[model samples]
Target chain A: MISIRWFLTLTLIALLVLVSFLSSLRGYRESMAEAETLFDLQLLEHVKLLGLLNPASFLFGNTLVIADSVITTPAELELSLQLLVVYQIFDREEKLVIRSENSPTENMAAFEPGYQHAEFNGYSWRALVAQDPLDGHWIMAAQRNDVRYRLAEAVTLQAVLPGVIGVPIAGLLIWWIVGLGLRPIQTLAASVRAREAGDLNVVELDDIPKELTPLTQSTNDLLTRLAMAFDREKRFAADAAHELRTPISVLKVQLHNLLHDLQSRQLPDAAVQTTRQSLQELGQGIDSLAHLIEQILVLNRTTPDQYMRQFTRINLLALVQDVVSNEFEQILARDQIFSLDGLPAFVSGDDTALRSLIQNLLVNASKYTPLGGQITITILQEHNKVLLKLEDSGPGIPEQQYAQVFDRFYRLPDAHHDASVTGSGLGLAIVKHIASMHQADIQLSRSQNLGGLCVTVIFQAYQQDNPA
Target chain B: MIDAVVIVLREVLEAMLVCCVLLASSYALGAKRIWLLPVTLFAVGGALLYATNLTALTDLFDGRGQELTNVLLLMLTGASLLFYLAQLPGVITQKTSGVTPALYASLIVASAAAMVRELAEIFIYIFSYGIASGQTAPVVSGAVIGAGVGVSLGIFIFFGLLWLGKRRCLQVSAVLLSLIGAGMMSQATRFLVQSGFLPGEHIVWDSSWLISESSLTGELLHALLGYDATPGIEQLAVYFASLLIAILLLRKLSVNQSLDVDSLRH
Candidate 1:
């Protein structure tokens, strides 16, 4: 829910901006203070220079020169010194002896010995005064407030400019760097996302971060346990089916012996007849159990995860015909009609699984169809696919229950149908597993002509040069 | 530069905070990240449009057009957020799968309206000084700083919400969005009063002595909750009234929806 990309990008940018700006603000203030001091020192130097000039007006005894109009610079001159700075010289009597054109006639300050503020000529000035040690005359040097402020601010701004400009650039760089740092996470996620459902292998990530080691280790541990569990489940089913087979075979043999013994001894009593009927029912139950065990073995062996695949090209029509011929006796016993149709369709799959797939389907059709019912098998190759369809004229399953019937041990309720017709409930589940192993699709619906269940299995047709 | 930072930061913070809460709320409701890109693009486009047309907008309504329009936009955004909040509990309780189209639409409208309102102000502030005075570098730089801080804080809060998990995330987002929606309504009321569309001279209380609205702490609080040192009766009324309506709507929806067996079980 929380993206590291956004978090790191934003927070790092914020930190960079904050630290950069704060430092710049400090630099701006310090630079401004330094400039202010330098300006004051410059003002003092100007006054001292004028004192060292020791103009002739100091010796001209009460004579004053106040030249208000003068032109001394070229038109292209950038600096107008008069507008920026003004100065005045006074005699020992505090009388104005000589002054710049821009200076007022009166004293600019309080005739002081140090720097002071003065308002004259409708402009605020920072004036500094110094005494001439030779004649004790005074020289006052002043700079206008507006000009000094502009100069000071311009100087200070240059120092803070970098910080302001670097933020956006730093933001971009941080975004990229953070993304680079988080690449391992993205790689690990992609690796996990790309895995197949049955792939329970340990996750392998390149250059994984230490922070993610625990997570990866825990995930691998979980996968190891899951693989073991799946193996246990597969082995358990096969072992249980194998264990049940011997007992079931023994029951069949014992039942047959008892039936033979009962027939050999002629019995006309009603009680004896009931015993014979009971023996027949017991034999049917044993047969159902035996069929259930066989189905469980098939299901365990054909499961996609546990089954080892050895694919070879085989004609689907021949396989279906062979299975139908083998199962024809069951249909004949029930007085049901059977037919096999369609061309030879080549498919790539394990021969054992395909044979099991066809045999189970044929057996299921014959077992469910009523006496005198019809059963049809067809194999067709269309486009790049082979389709095997088995239709039976019997009580068809409801459309809604089609998906549920494929689940192991899930059977249709017997209340509405013939209760005598039994099922192991694992036939379709085994069929589904085998079909999936071969990358096939199964569809169940009502047969149009047979008016019963139509089961269709579609498989990719094997090409010689390009095996499916 | 400091002024620029403060201005841009406050606006960006307000908009980003709204986005964070809404994004968290949408995620809680099982909405996908598909809308985020398009919504952001649209919001930025809207901000540009509003900024470019600012002069024409200012000239309307006898020179009071901007304020009135801001009031309308803020009100609409607040109303949209309220609608989203009302649907939050129901969606979380499994009454629907993910966000419904109507809910998603509300989110889009709310996001765009709030983003445009906040970001246009920053664009206007930046462009006016940057272009006119040739101070583009410093002003834009300050904006970048402000935006960085605001977005960073938004991301932090978004992760904090996620760390709280789904149920608590929804609850916190609801509360945050309620306050934000109320703040928007209060701001809208202020705009209305400033434009003379609503008249109010009554100062319910002044807290400037304690927390001056111009201070940094005050500005952050203002961006978060529309903190006013001198709020009028109308402003107070609208703020509390909108907040109360949002809470009441959430309560009603949650209580009514909780009775459904499927909703409660989920």
Candidate 2:
């Protein structure tokens, strides 16, 4: 997943760049418009100024040049002219009566009935024609469109240039600002990163950014969970190690004592038999320890995060039949009858994990059941789930003990606790984890018909659209 | 208007590429709880729009208000950069997961929001510029088109870079993020300087040989790199100092990485 910090930075930069870009554009447009309007206004003013100077000049058909003293001189026009290009006046028949020196294309005949825009001599032009009522002649004026547009272009450029520059700059600034803004997050990250794997203390929240409070809190929540899980695993490992070490140490001591006794003297028949019996018992104890160690390792591997087994679709009926058949010889050795009931069931899960889960259930059932006890395995499809039931004629778990049985190393007080019985107290826990990985649930209850323990696992049925 | 739209489309497309990379990486890792990625994107996207509005609102206020807002934004940007960098190691070293679909979706939404916000701002600027320039539609259109093309090109390049980076196993997400962050920081500084909160005459030294600010190309480069045409002593000094500091920090971080690698080998 993208880190929150990077996400925020990207977002902020994107926004700033966008704003800067648009603003620059807007600025350019505005300046251009302002230039155009100013040009139009100046042109109008220039026309008005000329009109005042020679009110009757057109009628008289004479160059009505007012003396410098009587009219506003051209020198006076220069100040206002700074914002405009060439301005001119044409008389009736579109003859140029008064014109600016820079004006190109003197043919006034081209000036049509309506206002027209033209580009000539590498310069754009806008001309207007109007009838002079007092003079009884057509009056026309045209100005270089370039001059107006150039000024507008300049203004637009000036206005937008900063934005063009500023956006990336703004983007950079935003990047830095975002960096500063995310300092708390960085601090949080640094604090987290600096931590040892075993450290799970609450992070300091005092300097966190307001925007990142939720994130920090969630991280802290995750840390709390990790800390708890870590602690649980550690304790479970320590407990298992301690329990198994004691049994192994005792077996070792007994074996050593038996060897020493044999070496010390020629033993009587009774003594020798007793020594042999002691050795056998020690062997059993060592076997139990080895079994317990194996169980603990299995339990550790089956933890949620560690369950990385590849899953595949398998026919539940076929798998169950295979497992039962493989165990048939063992079942017969114990004088137990095995029966399979129900139709073929299909499910998706890790083959190994599923096998282990079934194996544990069957073993548990077989261990508690008396000789000649019958074991039944049934797989049924109901609604949107596959339910597998393993029931045996054994002393069933109590209602309260059902939940406890799933706990690692938990053993019920009333249940069979024969020292010779091979059990590591981890089978049910492994089964629980495997079921969970497949999105399945397991329940333990008494088998009504068998007067024995019933272990049922229900898994969500795989649909074509939603693969497991 | 169409030009402005194009620019917005381009920038949004770039953001889309970054989002896509992030999503793909997450998916490859098989991470559960991936939905958070999209939700985060939406939330951040909304916040960005709000920030733009905040910028405008602050502008309406007195100088102090604007300065305050700018400072706040600057601080936010800086913090974000540091935070992102600090998380880089975890992201790179951790096993990849498949939690990217939701993340990508969110990023796309966020990027889209950012694009729209920017487009609107450009439109407003264009309208105002038009009014100022005597309502010349062609000039306004040209500017809009220029901006649009620029943004589009940026997006295309970003995606192209991402693709190349992916092929090289270069972690494009982090690199793009850093570049984007740098761009934002420069933009913030420009605003501060233009507004007169930051002094302009902070020139540390003149380094205009590579890109003189007077020419058009130089100006473009200056805009991109926070180059001052006529450097104020203060502006130049601040610029170089910041660059040096950033470089040093980066070096230190790289060194840390090497140290980590060495320790792992041991």
Candidate 3:
């Protein structure tokens, strides 16, 4: 039920985001740390340059050195120093000789050659102390902590920006790629869905992916087994019919000869007359058996798998007229009224199958209808579909039994009790199989006109390019 | 950026864990579709409404309203999950074609409740920082990362459960729900204590030194098991008690319900 395509796409995109973004975060942190170290080295280099400035020689005299004095006088000075470095210079004796305006008039750090954190001028600073080797002046250079942190963060953000922006694009590509990778599966499914129930052939796919090989193989194996099973069933029915036909024919002949011989003896005994009646009954039973075998063979031939599928365009009205002409004698013998009325409709189907389908419907109608009842056959072409309807004035089938009657060997409960109607229960089943082979639909309902069973077989009309 | 990622990740993971567990449970029960679309819409709509009215909500109950509301939501989610667990074993063992509407409703409610609070918090956090500081780039990037990890982990867990097969999935889901429900119950107690609804506080222990709440492993554990480095005595009592009740209910009710069904058939 889960769509492998969507699952793979979403999961892959998520994993990409997780891995790439986490790495970017790590890169940002590392870049910031590196930037911080580089800024510290710059601070050290600045302090060395200040040591070379040797500000003590320019002082000329003792300068007032302030202690614990916070610079709060000039707002502009503080604002400038917030983004710039603050520097201070001191003599070897720790007296402040020169200082930036933002710096207090005090030694920023102890007169030692090292870096240290100190609070002065109401701001925290990273101060580096280095002795002027030439003039022995203790020089200090410092940067505000906030300014350094801002610089590091800005630099790192620049490095991590591209990865953040590329995520949406990567997600689109992953979706497309995952769908592309799963194409074979979709193709296999579509091919299987397009097949007919009787078309149990091994599935053929081009460029099958390795992942789907086993699946296709298993499906093909099942199809092969099913096709073989159906073949066995068809052969069994056909073989039994063939095998039983010979013996039943011989029995019929032998009984006919024996009855003829008995009659030719010209005996007037009562037992001889009884023997004649019994022989007649036995002959009828044998005829019924022979009819059953022939029906079975027709059923097997109409099976879609066993059909040859050679189709031709024929006028359905013309075919129905021919079948009615052939079956009219039976309808007349029963004193039943018969009618074949319709428009000329062209249908593409196997000739023999269509003939069999029409004959079975006509026979079933006549057999079920009472004497002097009406049987109607109509063929109509409506909007590219041809509807073949057969109705009879007989005991109509129940609505619930409509679907069941199509099944092979299935008959109505009333049919069993009506000994007058002799049937093999294979008429409608054969009709259904042939109709399906011709790609037609069969619907059984109570006839509105004749008040009995109505069977409708709808077929797609044949479209001809050239009309005479 | 790191702070944004951590904050968003924690909330997303918590919500995703509950959704994944509920989804897995529905899958185990042979549900074809898990009402995902409706559930997501409900959760998101509720979260948006809650975030928009957050100021009004905070003003109520003398500014302890959010805590009290959170406590209620957490408790409701825990109870719903327990109810869902109660029906799982029997339905799974019986091999029903689909989950019953009642069980499905309970799962949807539990997932939506788990999600609304967490999603609202993320919305509030991201928008406030994005508008106030004008730092959209870093914050958005962090959120993207957090949501990615959380969603990915949830998908992994969902598939993992599926791979375990139906029976084992139900069993594991039951145990997982018990633990998660216990965690929610424990969290509810914390919120109550924070609102001063629960009396004086008592510290059970503090293991922040060993595993800080901000670390990666700690955050994952918090989302999965509701791990608290500094769990109070009240939270511990509620956690264990709720856990025990969930386990007992899942085992006893499912078995008894199966027996009842068999008896009725007889």
Candidate 4:
């Protein structure tokens, strides 16, 4: 695609050219007018000068010497020729008196009858007839049109040529100036081009043009975003590495202990029992690894760019009931009391993702709540949105840590010590990401009545007929 | 003629210098493969400049078109300068593997290539100018020579400063960039002024001793620097405000970097 710069430049140059041409034409026309006026003035002056030299004899041809002197002089001949061809003079009876050598070979009788003047053969001529006061004779003068037209042409070309030459030069200068002016943009592009993926630092383009201030600022804004993205990625990788290492280390240590016991040939009953316990611990470690891998997959899938969830109308009450039923095993094992309430609500979301979301929340509540703690899942319909509330009678999250819980791999400091209640720490982040993709909002608060953590997922409401 | 050629040559040489710097930097940073990006851009820019004979293009737009073109050119120059200034620090601080070094070298080469492209554009401009003016070869040739000398001198100055600054163990890239940015902003502002998009107060202050609007020198200065003796109010305001903003931004950046370093030390 042609960039805006080139498009703009070409458009500008074209506009300049057009303006130049019109102005040049106008200028040409003006000059032509001026030339005509000047020529008319000269003609009038010549007529006056001749009239002062006894116009009657000159008109009647009695003053032959004077007439020949005026017409035949080299200067006078040259001046007449320079002005145009086809000059003529006539008497009152319309008798031809004087004619230039290059005058058209037409019968004088034919032209004498009519006083009408017109242009012919690429030349415009003016004819004037005046009667002599002394002899009752007439005088006429006529000249060709080429001189005026030629002057006009010359004026037009002169007016246009500078624009012709100057515009391109100006254009080139403009291009160069544009290039120079765009030097900062080029510099900006180059700067951006020069950056490595790891380099998300701020761009400090100190001397940018005013026109490019917005561009520079936007570019800087992009850099800030990119930096944030990079930081997030780096942190994610670090957290993953740290989290994965613990289980692997535990498995390694258990295997090592079993090998040491076996090597000592001290296969006492106590030693056998200890080896079995070590094997069980290793199995548990492997299980944790599997769970971590699953969480990672979920985390990756939940990335907005990776996969888009299909939205369909889902019954909130039914979805909640299903999730609670699925988590009954864990709830029963932990002896946590679970209940559901509220009306049937409809929400727009991907069913599978929603189920996963609800299941995770329920599992999280089950795990975090103390034994025999009560869990309540409620579905409520509000104006334009459906709310799914999951409340647990566990130790409520600290107010400060509520926001942090949604961050990937963020486990509360106290939660880290409980190895019995293992978690991948990506559940809330996955939920948040999925929620965002569905245009839903999730919030954490202290359950006023439950005296525990209350997590709410708000979804856009769906009408019964318009499922989408 | 000399004037035209000199202008062409100057622009080309400057373009080349930038290309060289980018290519060298790419090589140093081990990112040689990416050289094609700048090369492609330069080629596109050159082809566009050459194919659209400046005169014909300007003629099409009518009288005010020339001023518009001038403004566009000025703005482009400013943008490029600012961009370079912004990236200087990163280029200096980046750790280069072989690939990175190559990339840097390519970037410098691309800059040089762009400069050469500009040179070609300059020649076209001069030639077109000559044809339009109906001037004889002598005049055209003189302009060309003058332009060439100007370009050579500009290159020399650019490199000389680079070398001197390097020798002094100072990263003059940032400073040089700022200057270039300031210059570009001034040019762009001037274009806006001439195009009537902004008021005549383009010049913040006119203390030109050698040139006044009534003098030939003043006309030359106006052509070269986008300087006007009596500028419009808005133009000056925009220019000064932009300059101040750029300076403040740079200062803030520097302060931030220093604070980061201090915290890191702790």
Best by TM-score: 3
The better candidate by DockQ, 1 or 4, is: 1
Model 2: per-residue Cα lDDT over B1-266, one tens digit each: 33434443443343343344334333333335454455455545644554456557565647455555544454344335434444445433433432234333433443333333344444445555555557445445555445544544454444444345332222444444444445445545656677777876554556577666555466344324544555555444445555554555455545555544432221
User: TM-score per model for chain B alone?
Assistant: 0.93, 0.54, 0.91, 0.60
lDDT of 2 at B2: 32
lDDT string, candidate 1, A397-438, tens digits: 999999999998888999636787788888889899999988
Off by over 4 Å in 4: A1-276, A294-312, A399-404, A415-419, B1-266
TM-score of each: 0.84, 0.39, 0.87, 0.39
Q: Is the docking of candidate 3 incorrect, acceptable, medium or high quality?
A: medium
Scored by CA lDDT, what does every candidate get? 0.82, 0.60, 0.82, 0.60
Name the best candidate (by DockQ). Answer: 3
Interface RMSD of 3: 1.7
Per-prediction DockQ = 0.40, 0.04, 0.56, 0.03
Off by over 4 Å in 2: A1-142, A146-368, A371-451, A455-468, B1-75, B93-121, B131-140, B166-216, B252-266
- Tell me the tens digit of each residue's lDDT in model 4 across A349-378: 777778879988988988888898999988
Per-residue lDDT, model 2, residue B46, is 48
- TM-score of model 3 vs. true structure: 0.87
Give the residue spans of candidate 1 off by over 4 A: A55-84, A90-96, A101-138, A144-159, A204-208, A263-272, A305-308, A415-417, B10-62, B70-95, B98-120, B153-211, B225-266
Better of 2 and 3 by lDDT: 3
